[model samples]
Target: MKVIGVTAPSTGSGKTSVSLALLSSLNNSVSVKVGPDYIDGSLGSAVSGKPAHNLDRWIQGRDFMRRFRWLSSVYDFAVVEGVMGMYDSGSPVNLSTDYYFRKIGIPYILVIDVSKLAESAYYIAKGFIGRNCIGVVINNFYSEKHLIIVRKAFSDHGVPIIGEIPHAEELKIPERHLGLKTAGEMPDIREKAVHFSQFIDFSFIDKLKDIPLIPEDRKPLLVGGGNIYVAYDNAFNFYYGESLDFLGRIGKLHYFSPLKGEIPENPHMIYLGGGYPELYASKLAEKSHLNHALKTYSDQGVPILAECGGLMYLESTFESKESSLKFPGIFGGSVKMTGKLTLGYTKLNVLKDNLLFRRGEVVYGHEYHYSDIEDSWEKTMQNVLGKGIQGYDGLYSMNTQGSYSHFDLMRYGKRLSGSIAKFMR
Candidate 1:
């Protein structure tokens, strides 16, 4: 498989442009998002008209190397958009995109915010360069002179000037909490893409024609012929395309929806990914029967893995389109929307052994949540659960696992894969 990595000096610089232009310029390429970023994933997926897979070492695991290999199996080219910086701003932790990139031996496109610095652009790019770095894309350029000098600096290093994208007032992505406003919130996101597409040089997309996509080896690392139920409904839809494909190697996939149809028959696992459950709370509550089925599945010891919005659905209530709505209350908590934004990257360690991940094993992940679930005296004591480990504090908490960390599956290679494998057992 041909793979290209897009990274920048900092967040919101213009790696999106590099990714969009490149992926759009590819031939049926698959997009893989690194870190716990969702906006870039949504944008990249839309660019290729394919589901983008998230490979976050924190959310996924260290041993998940095989999962990455498994994910890009059939794709001709894979574009991985990096998180914050190429190297960890803090520590050399598990699930970092850079860690995964070096592990997978994939080349990348360095995008630097050259709005201020001229030759320094080349310096930042050089500092973060690797054997995997293909070239540099100078993004968010402010002046033509700066662009010229910046281009020349890279030229001096023999680095190809892939493309230079100027800053535009219109292309700003809307944000709330930690992640971009749920893709659903901005119905006009397509317009933004179209606008960016106009100014973005699509030639870079074509330049990647011969780039190699790293391929995956499908070996049975998990239990045999596993039955995996992937969540795909509007309520819980932040699942990684590659995650499912990787899991598919060891099992049969049965997709069940709480907003659309019935749950699949007797499956070994129930997968609930992340999404805006608050946006579809009414619909989720309407499907009381489905909720009951989920509760039954959980009671019967069917492995259920949920994250963010998926976790919210498992709770008792969430405010939505209709009045206050009630759900399965499988884990028993009240999910409420908050005007305050709670979002950022995190390092979560598994405190207790569970189906997914091992104790003290670290996973590099992110959490962007706009809702709050307060602990009640009765529920906390009765369930012996403390808001079920999520967000930043409880990010690395215990069993039948999940969190608000909307990270890419690639980041948490081994740890995430092994952890999830435990649930299948």
Candidate 2:
């Protein structure tokens, strides 16, 4: 599909606003995503009424990542919201959002916050934009003079300022440390989307008409049969649109919520992307039915991939600041919230060719979580702990892999699906 990336300097820079305006403005749109994402999928689907896929490069492998690249032939357009700052999304410089732009070669629509500066906004935009830039959206403009300055910034960069969204009357509410609280978490989020779209130049789609179509050779691998159930809900929410769309390209992908119900039935594969499972540990624990369902399937050798909270859930127990509770007990360890912060960019130097990752392959991605091993519970997970680049910790495991690595599925490269498709087929 014709994909364009939506990016910003840091959180709350109107990436979602620009994304929504574009989704609402276009038809049959999807979102490629990154980070411990939830809000983008929530809002993107709200605007388009389609299930958005999580295309996180960090958490999975290439085969799973591009499972749906051929979607361009199925949908009108695809919009990808960048992970952290363009370059800051990963643990190092190369793994940044800017790096992903070049990796995927998707043209970008740079969203600049005109709050602190007007004409200087161009520099902020210039700093974020790499060579693949296609357009711009000047969000949070204050006055007529501000618009002139922002317009000039785009003109100088040769990047069209698609929309100069004004200081949204709705965005002024307080935010938590993670980022803007979800619109679903807040009732006014819908109104905010509607109100924010007013400021965006909705007609930017017209300019993209000349943007060339992606060649068939580069499309994601396609599949016509077999079951692949992905976790899509308030919890287990870390997903990218491109990744999921790509998955749907190759399998009969279905979604089941870990938040509200049981995992979908009799699936051959399960994908659990990232999300704040720590927030709902007790409730998720209460879903003994679904928990056991996954536990049984994992035990039965259904190929499964879970990241972040999904990884946490597979453990024996989940402990966050809220409360500690029993987990599905599928993996080999107990996860307890660490008093010290446990978060950063990580490079997974592949140890061996296993079910998912290859031997000696290094993957780039980020890790952000407040949990760690409990000193009291060390013996249960003592053998499983891993640390640093190659995860030299040499920890333990079941058939499943649970890690803070958070690498992308797409970058596992073509060997990703090529290798795994045989097992499922």
Candidate 3:
């Protein structure tokens, strides 16, 4: 299918808004986010009636691009919403919008903020103008005169102005510390999506052409053979859509919430992804039965996979700015809330053979957390890229595993599913 990327000069330049508008304009189009960010992908998923996928180079490397390109061929058109800025790259590699555009070999439309510019919009577009940039989209232009001037500026330089979206108060999405609220929580998503689509010009939507379908097999992975309990709620909702999809394919996936004081009934394995666990530490601590259940399960050697916020929730204590709360203490580490933010893409080398990874095997992922464990423990993975710090990550104890790194299960589904299957066995 024809693929196009939507990028901005910088963050908060209406990239996600424009992407959702474009998705609404197209007849049969889907979108993906080009970073480890789950927020924009969630919004795009809600706006467009499709499960949004994240295409991060660090997590999946180059293979994900090819796979996504192939998978997107099923749709009439595909759009990729970029993260941060157009040229911003992650640490230790060229994992940015430019890198993905060049590697995926797709043309991108630059979204320029015209709220503060008229003629200067041309210069802004020029700074980002390259062979990959097919056209430009004027964003936040409230006045018709400003839109005309910005359009004329690009048009004068022989560059096409594809769309001009006006500044609207209702267009701004509600956000928390993590970013935009998950689409499920966002009110009037459909109404907002329709309103945003009115700002875009759909005449050029025909540019997206169909591509040859390369045969791709979609076989199911090794089944878990047992029910899997997944921690999911506002406090622990940072799971990738692909990860949940894979889980559904492997076993009967059930969701439980520590905040609700509920534990799954007889779970074979517990998968806690990540989210704002620190925000609800007190509520989680109040759930005595849930803590006891988790501790009991760990003592019984039931396999558990926890990441980032999940790691914090499984800690002995979760210390936040407001209050200190106790957890299961299944893992001895204690988490401390701090102003410091640890965010990056990581390449983890397995230090020892485990169900999820083999000895010496390398796995790629991302980490974004503000809380830090108070004490160091024996680590199973070594960080080759990003700030894994002190050459170690992931706390391993018996059948329990916890880490700060969030992985791309879509790219590594087979290996992870096989590991989960083994855990069930």
- Specify the highest-TM-score model's number: 3
**Model 3: worst 10 consecutive residues (lDDT sum):** 208-217
- Of 2 and 3, the candidate ranking higher by lDDT: 3
Q: Residue 27 in model 1: shift from native, Å?
A: 1.8
> Higher-TM-score candidate among 1 and 3?
3
Q: For each candidate, give its TM-score against the true structure.
A: 0.69, 0.71, 0.91
Per-residue lDDT of candidate 2, residues 1-425 (tens digit)? 56778888876787877777677766787655655465566667767667775654445545433434555655778888887666675343344667656766777877877878877888777777766776778877788887897788679767777677777565654455445555456665555666666766655555554234443444556653567788876666665555565566667778888888666786766777767777778888898988888888777666677766777787777765666687878765667755555566555555555445556655655565666643221111111223421243212243355555454554442443543365465
How do the residues 87-177 of candidate 1 rate in per-residue lDDT, one tens digit apiece? 7544345545577778767777778887778788888778777766777777778788768888888898888766667776666776654
Candidate that beats the other on lDDT, 1 or 2, i.e. the better one: 1
Pairing residues by index, what is the TM-score of model 2? 0.71
Instruction: Please give the lDDT score for candidate 2.
Output: 0.64
lDDT score of residue 390 within candidate 1:
37
Task: List all candidate RMSDs to the true structure.
Answer: 6.1, 5.7, 2.4
Residue 256: error of model 2 in Å?
Answer: 2.8
Q: Model 3, range 347-398, lDDT digits (tens) per residue?
A: 8889986546778888989888777786466788888875553557777877
Candidate 1 ranges beyond 4 A from true positions: 49-51, 54-61, 64-73, 91-107, 112-135, 138-160, 166-174, 181-216, 220-227, 261-268, 319-324, 338-366, 375-425
Query: Which candidate, 1 or 3, has the higher lDDT?
Result: 3
